[model samples]
Target: MSKQFASAGDMAEKQTSFTEIGDGLWAFTAEGDPNSGVIIGDDSVMVVEAQATPRLARKVIDCVRGVTDKPITHLALTHYHAVRVLGASAYGAPQIIMSEPARAMVAERGKEDWESEFDRFPRLFQGHEEIPGLTWPTTTFKGRMSVYLGRRRVDIMQLGRAHTAGDAVIYVPDANAMFTGDIVEDRSACYCGDGHFHDWPATLERVRRFDLDAIAPGRGGALQGAEAVNRALDSTADFLRSTYRPAARVALRGGSLKEAWDAVRAECDPKFADYAIYEHCLPFNVARAYDEALDIDTPRIWTAARDKAMWDALQGG
Candidate 1:
């Protein structure tokens, strides 16, 4: 029944690749695992999207050490997701930066989310006990915040809500590189458990304005050049549209949840089946899309118990 739960039968370790997307920009991707972007400044370094735990974070730290000895001075969280923000303590980056909405999310559901995600994906949280609890931002800002990594301008700005209300991207103007959190996924399936489906496309439209030379997405390989970047962004948009459109059509016709779910499966399964996390995310994605189609603007909080219940019902367990 969809691997019983999230990542239940999948526990194989992935080969990590730390590729330099630009002169001073690095992207750490592990097959289809969550990616962490690196920006090497003239003086200190800045890390984007911390892994799930302190032990897992050490692997990223080692990769950074292989390139530069510069102490990381900033840890930028793209959102308030547990898997992305829990490992922040390992970086020891003095300043943790997040948008005001992100900080609010951390306050609203950080503890519940932490417990929920850990249960869902146990392998990613190899050192769960070491986590110092929910990661909090040292500094919060609204709209856009300009960060200078020795004149290499890293712009931390909120485009809109896609993956979460607090979703943000780290943009390096000179490098023509943008580090997008779950707002943009390449080959991996987008997890919409806490997403805003209605607003996701508009947020992606804002991402296009950057005229990117390279884009380090949330998962999968980094995109190089404008053409590849555009294609990746388009792919993300297509995913959102294909799911929401069909579901909305069903909901509008007063169809049942199963009808809505089956409609999405028939349309999206063939198109997205081979993508990473496709199986794990389908039910959740459909549920969110179903709600959004009914004009539910905000995403509902997913607890561990709720996750199992949803999966059981949708998977016909």
Candidate 2:
């Protein structure tokens, strides 16, 4: 049979874990699915990345309630992907935050993304019917902004573009911990469908300079301590380079997208074959890397039709 499209064939539910990486901060992670971060401040809480649907988000809510009852005052999204933002309603947080550019992407392609992602992985959208609509940020900033939950100061900053043109990282200074949405994944494949391949490494470097003690990454297990944090950072950078270099070589040589796909697989599979979502992410990552090699600065929007076309083409590669 033809390879399943995206993650459509992978229906096994991931085992979820809620880890306390800092004083009051938690990382709500699944085996390899998307992750949500929790920051329990003095008087309230700030949640990072809303998950794929209200039902999935409720799982996060249940985890939060197990620890504290602080009202979720702010919902911060790292980027505009449906898997990250469509579940906004569940939070009931008064203030929703995103970078200005991220908000713009939501306007430009939110609906299309919602459809494409839902089509790609039906399992993630457990309660698709409950998703009211595209998620929008109530509060937006250009580069940096700070939100204080009573006494704790959480710095939400857009360091540079990596996973998306408008990715943001949430840093809690008092704990020296950060919530890096898809910008840094712990042994999970970085989804590059809307990514900036050429700019990703530099952005990772900027995140590294922070010298974080712990990180609630976009996916996979939580990273605690300087050594573990640094390793994930380095591995993420390596994954990007391994994916882009071979694809770029093929594109520069006037090769086809399928050729680029094979090139990337040959280069990346040996190293990252065991990583979470590696197969699900390969085609999209190769496509973007091929485009970037040709100097395509902006990632093209992905629609359901385009997703199918790309997957079919790569399947025969």
Candidate 3:
């Protein structure tokens, strides 16, 4: 029984919601869909993640408009995923900020990723025509950069790699809120197809050192207060550790890819099967983890053909 390739079979549009999670901060979440964030400064605004298309991004803009009239000044790319940065033009932000590696990623395989993601998740890319093409960041930084919207200070920091080679998190110290990209998810599946599986936990620990009162995850709802924030962090760490560690061990012992896949499923499925995109993410996640376990430090570029081949193989086409 072969499984569908990635999210190709998932076409249901999720219900989007905007929630006020902190002072001058908002979380735009779709029911188990890719999440985005907004931070309002006294004089300007920053959008954390762009939606899949310009049309979808307009909805996020409306959400921002509902609360404040500040001009959107900066659009931050948490990483270089097409769904997270392609709709950036919709914000019309003067400065599009991203890590250097993220910028490099856009240059490396941006077009291929765009077509691949569009093919996998058509519902999210409903307004694909509206996209101006691969979004290139106007500003690129190496590590930490401070952004100020008047008196408000937002710290954009790259602790280490997790979901991608350049995962970044936005922190508002005064508000005690953090907008973590795909580095940490509340309930949504951790799509590790481009991740650094072995180092992900260490990176999460670096993020944990900060005193965060609330967190707007890359997916799922905003986690409010310290307790909820801590829980989400722990859950994300557990998901990474549980899935990758076992897969790595299997690969180290020269186990079959299917064996590693089954091991990951046996460990993660019982607890995470109900999470959003779990089924869609598992095979890819396991494959990447297996590669990492076998001494492959970098993830292979996922083209449309590669995605289908990997899914078909592990799912037994």
Candidate 4:
């Protein structure tokens, strides 16, 4: 299998798909693109992971309106990703929430991430000019926060570091469902550019502790049933291990960055070739994994110039 890349034109014309995961809960997906989750409580609504821009977020708003007329009261960011949180302003929710660590990451490297991601995937950043700026959390919690939507309860918890140091998940015990940000991608490749690989598996263990019947992963279709949920979790773990182990091996051998990337690509591309965004994510994933294996604690910031330089160096100019 060969990895398929989405051109900017293809993303521009793509249509988002919204599917009901549970009663009053919807998953807004777009052909393995960025995903958003919606939870409609008795009195109001809570949107999880705003899209890339306000214009894009409006499409999700329209989907929620199709089912309920309740006002959006909160916007929840699963992590500090430009493609995921930049569209938060469109929600107009009084409360925008995130983990404390996530807020810190936004404050530290948010600007560089915005420029890096926009350059990497221009299609997702349509109407990039409409963005007010980096999405800041008006409300932040350290460990966990539980909010009631009338009778419905949504628990947002920072399980551990996975996709990023500030990764979080939204768990609904009533529905036995969990909305895992990028912590666990179903059919899509996990973007581990800023990830903590060693901590990721442990984070997955925390996520599995919940008796979840279904999962709204950050990308791809929602996982339904115990079998499918297990499969998603297993696949995500496998992806991390396969990519990190090989990259780690190459780095330990004192190989060049190109050699490490080739090692990861040889190992992962063969197995995850059919997964969405496999090619787009590999370079960054290998770079971070290489750094981590060499005892680099914090991932380096990815500016637009750095992104092009890395891509050209690895994939050829």
Give the lDDT of residue 298 in candidate 2: 90
lDDT for every model?
Answer: 0.88, 0.92, 0.88, 0.88
How do the residues 1-317 of candidate 3 rate in per-residue lDDT, one tens digit apiece? 44565477777767898988888999999987889999999999999998888888999999989998989998988999998988888887569999999999999988888887877788888868878788998998998999989999999999999999988899998888899999889888999999998788898888788868889999998999878888888999999888898899889998888889889888998899999888878888898999988889989999989887886677662
Q: What total of clashing residue pairs does each candidate reach?
A: 0, 0, 0, 0
The pairs that clash in candidate 3 are none
Q: C-alpha displacement of 221 in model 2, angstroms? A: 0.7
Ten-residue stretch with the least lDDT total in model 2: 1-10
Model 4, residue 252: what's the lDDT? 94
lDDT of 2 at 251: 98
- Where model 2 places Cα greater than 4 Å from the true spot, the runs are none
List candidate 4 stretches off by more than 4 Å.
1-12
**Candidate 4 per-residue C-alpha lDDT over 1-317 given as tens digits, one digit per residue, 9 for 90 to 100:** 12222333355466678888888888998878889999999999999999999988999999999999998998889999999999998988559999999999999999999988887787888798899899999999989999888999999999999999998899888888889999999889999989999999999988887868889999989888888898989999999999999999989998878888878888887789899887778888998999999999888888988877776677551
Query: Candidate 2, residue 101: CA error in Å?
Result: 0.4
Instruction: State the lDDT of candidate 1 residue by residue for 1-317, as single tens digits.
Output: 44386576678998999999999899999888889999999999999988999887888899999999988999998999998988988987569999999999998888889888888787898879999888999999999998887877889999999999999999998888999999999988899878988789999989998888998999989899998899889889988888888888988888876777889888888888888888777778888888888888878888888887787777662
Q: Distance from true position, residue 56, model 3, in Å?
A: 0.7
RMSD of each: 1.3, 1.0, 1.3, 2.3
- lDDT accuracy of residue 187 in candidate 1: 85
Runs of candidate 1 with Cα error greater than 4 angstroms are: none
Best by TM-score: 2
CA error at residue 190 for candidate 4, angstroms: 0.6
